[model samples]
Target: MRTCPHPFASLVLLITLSAAAQPPTSPLGPVSPTTGLVLRDDAVRALIQESSGDRIHDGVQRLALIARDTQSGYTEAAAWTKTAAEAAGLQDVRLEPMKDGPQWRATRGELWVAGAHRYRVTSYADLPMSLAAGSGAFEGADVELVDVGTGTQEAEYAGKDLKGKVALTRGPPVAALRNAVVKRGAVGVVSSYSTPPWNLSHRMDGDFPDQVGWGLVPRSLSTPGVPAPFLFMISDRQGRELLAQLRAGPVKVDVSIATQTDTGHLSIVSGVIPGTRAGEELVLTAHLDHYKPGADDNASGSATLLELVRTYTTLIRRGVLPPPVRTLRVLWLPEFEGTREWFSLHGEEPVRRVAQFNFDMLGASLTRAHSRFQVSYTPDWNGSFVNAVSESTLAFMNRFNSVVYPPRKDFRIGSVTGSQDPMDAHMERYGRGSDHQLFNDHGIPGVAFSTWPDDGYHTSGDRPENVDPTQLHRAAFAGLASITVAAWAEGAGALELARLVALHGVRRVAEDEFRARRDLTSVPVAELPETYRLTRAAVRIAYQREREALRSCLSLGAPAAPVQAMAKALESAEAQALGRLEVDGKARGASLREASPSAAERQARTFVPRRVKGQELASFDELARKAAPEQQPRVAAVQAAITAAETALRERGEGELRFYQLPDALASYADGKRSVADIRDAAYAEYGHVFPVDALVELFGLLEQGGVMTRIR
Candidate 1:
């Protein structure tokens, strides 16, 4: 969790992993050092204070305070935030003003909208909608209105004339609607949707397209904004029903949306506490807009960021904070729009780089009231930042929950990199959801934090009581810690920083590389070819073939019985080797000597990555000759298996398994007799197995239970 920046969960695979420091004394730490400095920065503290805001805890006091403050357009909350920062002795703190666009906003009681309508209306209830918008061609004008739904399928309007009439469509990809109306020569367009305020819909940046010359009419009908005949949008259930009825009666709506129609106001916030190295930038951020108060919605995140700035400023003032390797830029935005402005203006990738840690919710506990602390992350081939960050976050969580806060594993941290590798796909899931949206959109390795299924995410229920100070403190700390790690790695040596990540953050769930490869295959063959840096000797390189082959055998839930048998054997062999092995002599293998693999086979199957003699296969003809070597009657089952084995080898080749150059696909661990599991253990980590085709498939569904590969999908 990043305080100046960045949520919670529950059965985690608690590996009993150790952290550098002993657990803290309380979950409510005034601070915890993530990278170098303390975690719970002032911004987080202020937010916690703000959550328990300076007013009576009564409903009227809160609403009255909100109502008294006018935050429309330039007269926004951001404007006041500047005054507050300055009052606190902060310098260079300014609100990043947002663009208001070409649309106009009407004042109270003014006739902001007035338009000619073939369908007349007195109130919202009388306005016609379905026939006026949903219908492709109504009342047969010279040109027909092309009714587009969502506009995702452009092929829907192959040969239609949409000249002069309205192009009524559905939802906002505002740019798309603008293009359609301008291209098709419609007078205007009306898009529709019936979603809630926080639905996200994966389509919000509503920036209208250029190269089009048409006015726009958005029939948004969602929870946030209303249709103004303004270029923007609107929604209402009862009114929509009445409008639908009137339209069914053949009424047409040509309502004016803009008399002076436009958004009320919008702006993004960016604050920087200059690091020693300003040329390199580390952007920490969160969004600050919701239909309501949005405490956990985002006020929590933005407020936390402010606290970080405050903490750093205090540290700098006291000269206690170390000069950073990179400049720290904390940004607060109105979701996508803030990021859009930054990218639209300054899209260049930061030359002096660390990583981006965006914290969205990050401060709520007990949606179920029994869930553990959670950490979500993103990974990259460039050593995957997400893996390390989550590891770090969980380390903090465990310390807080287990040691500091007392005996409870209630707080747990994890990164999204586990089941869904956003680094491979769906960075948008995290990136687009918050201020990081633009960062990822710009191709930076970034990760954002927010609570999952937050009960009061966007609704009125999203008040300050929902926030957890303990969680907020952890988030602030985690964000700073990961950023520092990334910066330290960039400024110093990458491997050193990476080692800290490996140690404090991310788990090498399965080491021997071979076993880990299985986790990859369970995902998809297409994914296996994707590169992940590995070390033959402490250096990283992407060798997809060997990785993929290992992945395939491990991926199969359970390969054929022969393969499972082989894997079990390999497991046995490694147990034996590891028993005699001692780096610091930690792993206890002496007690299970009988459980070890065969001595000869175990020695042969050492971690050499090349097949040794004795277990080696000759040419197919030679193998056939040996299979029938002077036997009175070769068993039919044995003969059939031999043929299958040859075919299996051929199939593996198609999948890029160069088995002939290596050893036979591990069939069993050396159970004093060498099996496949033993071979894998010998090859990699503890308690391992690698099933080629048969046994691998069976294991896929089973391994998930043990947090091996939770689910292939």
Candidate 2:
């Protein structure tokens, strides 16, 4: 018997059996006939019916009134959230302080052309986004405006003298500021960046003539040698006018910026609704920081979470819903940085957390924003039954709302004025953009509920009016229902979850096999064996994920009998799947031995590889300095590739590219127990063919050269 970490695990089987014998008569609802699980229809109805769209809209409007990144704004919002939670009868409501570096505030900003064309460009008093975040204080000074296309590459400034001038670029303000101000000695920077619409399915206008976003100049670039400069963001329309003026004649601008940075703490608001079990928790989180009028980006998410908290607490207080078996904790904080600080302060508190449900941009109007409500799963490597649970809940809500409130000509809900149409919710693959990444990085299963393709994202135009209350309600309903089921699940619920994992695993394995077969045409004949190995390994990984999902039920204190039965069933299922594959391989004149590597082929497995934390290859020169004298040429080639990857990532506004083009299966084999030859064989076993041996060598070599990993001798 496996020792359970949870103290309540011992009582789970007893409570589950007792509950099953005597069904509660009150608000606990009925027991599922098929799976013997408890179904709280009353709780589900309260979550759906009690959720107020109007209340959510009001919350968004109130929060959108101030830029929440500022100290005063953050404190006010935190206080308001705490008061709201307390008013809803939630327990342990508090304002937790996070140790963020500093608070940045923009007070004043102005830019005006003085030579040949006397006209004002933009002002912070008129638009906060025009000032850009992290800009330092500067007085009015007339400087020539130099148009450097993109302003990121050194070639952009080949013959241009940027000293004492303001460089204008089409890239983002942060990138342009780094290149022109810190690197080229420019006094300031101006950026005109826009995200173009790729779809006309919803038929919304794509032109954003006045949209501007936040920017940052790292403190590292603000040293005495390289002074950080005041950066300004303008719309594409304003950029075109300035560029045209520059082309006609010499144009100089008078610029003045007043911004301040001081030591400050980030405010994180948290509240809990206690459950029957102790220590077990499910966290619901949303970011509370953004520019003023950041409605769809995050205010919508915060409002939705608040509404859920209100609805849940109200139902529990009224005795219409029973308390869950696991605690429900809600958190409102700054984005990634704030989450990191919270984790640092809490230490191992996260170990008690079973799952995280993150809300971000969940209230966009589908027709206006060209958005789709998505429940994005955690990546395959972190697969769990939570994915199926969330997906099923969203699908159920989508169907329920369509029948109850069909889309009218005005797109209003039934008898509700100004409300939008029903939600067009769908499942999406894994994506990394919000605070959920922080939770997932700490081994917590985190999922995101968001709306994508919002035109007002990170822009001055994102206001409360653009948010759809009906969409917010639907998202809240889905999130509430999914998490409630997980929090209150018992023996029967665990069995149901196990079944879903098995089905999902089978489907995933079939999809992997299909993809591998399709990729065979692209593989070289010599590498076919490696490809076959990789494909098999993928199937094995799918089975293992299913097993892990089933085992996780043990954490919920499920009965040993049912849990063991499910494990045995899974073993048989995996055997049947593998047996079919083996039979197919035999008919094709191939054998299992051809796919699996011999013992002699395996390298020594005693050496362990450890990854170096917080180390990055910042530049080609840094890579050369780290590499040995004889390895400079190879390091230089890899450095060039990394540089190009970084450039591409910047242009696309995406994350870093540490393992670009490397298969997850291959990467997973890099654990200390596996040697380089073992990893190669594993890759072939899973992917249906091996990658070039030289390619694997180069990858490990680059990792060593870049200070990311070191081999234990």
TM-score of 2: 0.81
- The clash numbers for all candidates, in the given order, read 105, 22
lDDT against the true structure, each candidate: 0.39, 0.68
- Give the least accurate 10-residue stretch of model 2, judged by summed lDDT: 197-206
TM-score of model 1 (CA atoms):
0.45
TM-score of each: 0.45, 0.81
List runs of model 1 lying over 4 Å from the truth. Answer: 1-71, 87-90, 95-100, 103-259, 262-267, 349-351, 368-375, 382-387, 402-432, 458-461, 484-496, 504-713
lDDT of 2 at 119: 80
